[model samples]
Target: MTESPRPSEGRSGGAQPAADLARIVVFAAFTAVLGTFPGIYLAGAAVPIVLQNTGPLLAGSLLGARRGAASVLLLLVLVALGLPLLSGGRGGIAPFFGPSGGFLVGWIASALVVGLIVSAARRPTLAVLLPANLAGIAVDYLFGVPFMAQAIGDLRAAGVASLGYLPGDLAKIVLVSLVAAAVHRAFPNSLPRRKAAAKA
Candidate 1:
């Protein structure tokens, strides 16, 4: 029986592992910056909503699945540890289990989903980009709305409350996708290079 050769033997070489780790760190820091940026604020809800999804979207597009998820989870851990890494300087484990809990969880899941889509697409033009952002938005809404309803004890009110932020969220999705595409063009190898090399 023949055994397949290891990746380093066939590809870039022994340095690939270190290179990959460096990319992971860079992406994680990028997400941290986006998460910490205090964007538009939605007050008086379960927790104030901010245009922080840009971090998840950009991470997924540029970092791909595993690493993108890691970036978001890293931010989550920081927030949970009371680092005030979230938008408007909100943090702590309570937010994770509070009204904003689902949205927080959604960040990880949505990053994964976006990464899966963007990675599979190989080359993300504007045509293919919006859908990926929408997927993350849907995930955010899927988890967030229910939690809001539960927390506020009124589904209608929660739905209405969420509407206030819809425009801002949509705007963030567009901005993030454009920036991600630009970064992808610039970095080219920021994401896992498997799919891209295959296409090339």
Candidate 2:
């Protein structure tokens, strides 16, 4: 009679919960560090050209939803505490209430959405990248537009101001997708395969 393998074998055999948690912590720190780049000051507005979104996107694509969201949350907390870890090295609660505050708050949701989509979709091909990035970017705008409108109390003004940033944000999304694809290829094992495992 052949004996069946123990529960600790096969899929559960190599699972390391502690190591996974440690990796999440380390990646969260890395996300915060990557957010320290400065923004470009325009005529009457500040345009952030930092690699901030890239970090969150990559974290989501590589860390799965919960850990990815945790990373963004940690970064946001640091910024709220005046860490000067945001674009243009701007931090403190003031930014959280400023014109760009909505976008800042939305980043967490955006990362969550991106990570969720990436995990749920199974295949991370080009088709999936477009929708994933678009959803993530849309989440950012959803928060940003309303906040900017409230800050200025002029819907048209807010929309026009936001237009100045559309091109840049789109470019950032493109770059993020590219980087995500590369990471998926080279470090496929980096992200936890919750969706795939379940389907299997």
Off by over 4 Å in 2: 1-17, 37-48, 195-200
Residue 180 lDDT in model 1? 82
Model 1 residue 162 CA deviation (Å) reads 1.3
Tens-place lDDT per residue, model 1, 1-200, is 01122364234212356665565567656666766655544555554455566788887877776667777777788778888777666688988777658778888888888888887784877666789988888887888889889998999988998787787788878887888888777887676766348556
- State each model's CA lDDT, in order: 0.73, 0.73
**Model 2 Cα shift for residue 149 (angstroms):** 0.8
Write model 2 residue lDDT over 56-164, tens digit each, in one string: 7767766766667666777788788888777667789998889979988887788788877887776676567667878888888899999999999988898999888
Error of 1 at 171 (Å): 1.1
- RMSD of every candidate to native, in Å, equals 5.6, 7.3
